[model samples]
Target: MKRNLLFSCLIIVCSSVQAIPISLEYQGFYQRLKQVNKGHYSQVELVFSVPNKEKCRIQSGNISTEKESFPLIITKEQRLFLPFDEKLKSDRALINLDIQGETKHCNIAMQVRAKQTKMEYTHGDIVEIQAEMNAMLSEMQGFPMRYFTTDIAGVSFLFEADSDVTVNIDGVVQSVSGKLRLSRAQILTLTNLKLSLKPKVISPWTNGD
Candidate 1:
C-alpha cells in the first residue's frame, strides 16, 4: 500500500507540471466600434493583462500594429496565451505599443519566418527574446524586444507566410510558422498588436461594437 501510494503521488506531481496551462482571449481595436470589410491590411491592437507582484499599478500593456509583439508574460504558477489564425500569421505588419504609465515604448518592423514547426512547453526555466523578421522596409533592425516578464517556463509565437508584418519575440526564436496562436493559463499574453498599414484586423465599422 505504501509503495502504491508513493507512486500515485509522484505521478500526480509529474502530470501537474507536464501540461502547462494555456488560455487565450481575442480582442480587437474595434471592440467598441463597427466597420466594413476593407482588407487584411488593417490597424489591429491587443492588450494583455496579468497579476503583478507589486501593487499600485495596472497589470496591462498594449501591443500596437506599429511593431512586433512577444515575450508574453508568464509567471511560475501561470502562463498567458495568444492564438493567431492562419490568415494573420502568414501576413506580417509593423507592431507598436506602449507600456502604459511608463515611458517605455516599442516600435518594431516585423514579419513571419518562411518555415514550419512546433514546440513542447512545460514547467521549466525560460528566457525571453524579441524575434523580428521583416522582408520589406530595409531600414528596420530585426532583433528581440525587451522582456516584460520573468520566471517563465515556456514561450511561443506562430507566424504564417501571408502575414506581411513584422513580429518581434521577447526571447530566442522558439518556433516559426505561417499559422499559429498563443496558449496560456489566463491568456495574459500579447500586450498589444496593432498594424501600421492595413484594412484592419477587426473592422469596427463592419463588425460593430
Candidate 2:
C-alpha cells in the first residue's frame, strides 16, 4: 500500500473540541496517490464533526470540481464519504456542507499506521470481498451472469478509468511467477470493490445465463 493508500484530510479550525468515540479513530481512508493504469475515484469518509443531533442536521451537500459537481449526502451519523482524489487539494475543489444547525465543540483525531490493500489478503479479506459483492448483487436487480462469472472464476475485475484487469492465481504464488508485479488497474480492482459503478447489462442476442 506504499503509493496506493492516501489519507489526505483538510481540516478547518473552529472553537474548542469535544470527545469522540474511541473505536472510530482507527478507521482507514483511501485515495489513490500515484498514477495507476486503471482506477476510480474513491469515496472516503469525512466526519464534519460529531455533532449534537439536535443541533446539526445536514440538509444537503455537494462537491465541485473544475468540470462537474456531484451530490454528497451526509448520513444521520454526521459522516459522509467524499469522492476522494489525489488532485483534489491542488484542483482547489469546493465541498458544500449545508447544515441546519451547528456545533462549536468537536473532536479532532490524528493517527498513523502501515497501509494495507487487497492484493495482500488472507481468508478474512476474502470474506470482506464477499460481503461487498453480496451488497452489489442485492442492489442491482437483474444483472447479467457474465458480470459475476468473471470474479467467480477469478478472471478479471473492471476498472472505470481503464480496462478490465485479470490476475493469475497460480502465478500470484506458483501459478505465474513474477506476475505479482501487477499494473495499477489490477491492483485497484482487488482493493476497492466498494465502488458504485454502473452495472453492465447483457446483450440482447447473447445468452446472459
Candidate 3:
C-alpha cells in the first residue's frame, strides 16, 4: 500500500511538471499562438495584451461560443478548446474570468482569425516551412509571449503529408511521418517531438530555441 501510494504521488508530480498550465486571462500575439492539436480539439488564438505575472493569476474562467461551453483550463496549455468542426469557424468567443488580482489594462482585441486547415508538408515545402519557422522564431525571440503560464512548448506546427515522408528539422530527418509535429522547445535544448504519435518521442537533434 505504501509503495502504491508513493507511485501515485510520483504520477501526480510528474503530470504537474509535464503539462503547462493554461491561462484564463493572459493575452498572446497572433504569431505567438501555436500548439499540437489532437483529436476533437482545435484551438483559436485570441489576441490579448501581454500579461504580467506579477499582476495576473487566473482563479477560474470559461468561454461560451455557438451555444457550447468550454471551461477554461487553468492547469494545461490546451486551455480553451473547441470542437474540430468549430475550430476556426467560431461565430463568437466570449470569455469570463475571475482573476486573483486586478489587472491594470488588458486590451483584448475582439477580432476573429482567418480560417486555415492543418498544414500539409510535401517534398518542396521544406524551404517554406523552414523560412516560416525561422521567421516565427525570430519574432518570438524579442517577446517570449507565453501566457505567463508554468511552461511553454514553443511554436508547434502540425504537418500532414499526402504520402509518407519523414520529418526533417534543421536538416535532420526524424522517423515521424504522415502526421507530424514540429515544435521549438522553450529551454536550451531544442526538443523536436512527434507529439501525436502514440509512442511520443522527444528527438534531441536540433539547436536551442
Top lDDT hit? 2
- Tens-digit lDDT track for model 2 on 162-207? 4333443424423222212323234345532221232121101101
How does each model score on lDDT? 0.24, 0.33, 0.32
Over 4 Å off in model 3, which ranges? 1-51, 76-88, 105-132, 135-209
Q: Which 10 successive residues of model 1 have the least lDDT summed?
A: 3-12
lDDT per residue, candidate 1, 1-209, as tens digits? Answer: 11100100110111121222222222331221111112122222222223221211223432323245544443332222334433323334212222222211111111212122223221221111211111111111121222222222212333334555333333333333343333333124444332222211110110110
Residue 76, candidate 2: alpha-carbon lDDT: 65
Top-down lDDT ranking: 2, 3, 1
Candidate 2 differs from the real structure by a C-alpha RMSD in angstroms, to one decimal, of: 18.1
Better of 1 and 2 by lDDT: 2
- The alpha-carbon deviation from the true structure for residue 95 of candidate 3, after best TM-score superposition, in angstroms, is 2.8
| Residue 153, candidate 2: alpha-carbon lDDT | 18
Give the residue spans of candidate 2 off by over 4 A. 1-50, 105-209
Each prediction's number of clashing residue pairs: 68, 4, 1
- Candidate 1: global Cα-lDDT? 0.24
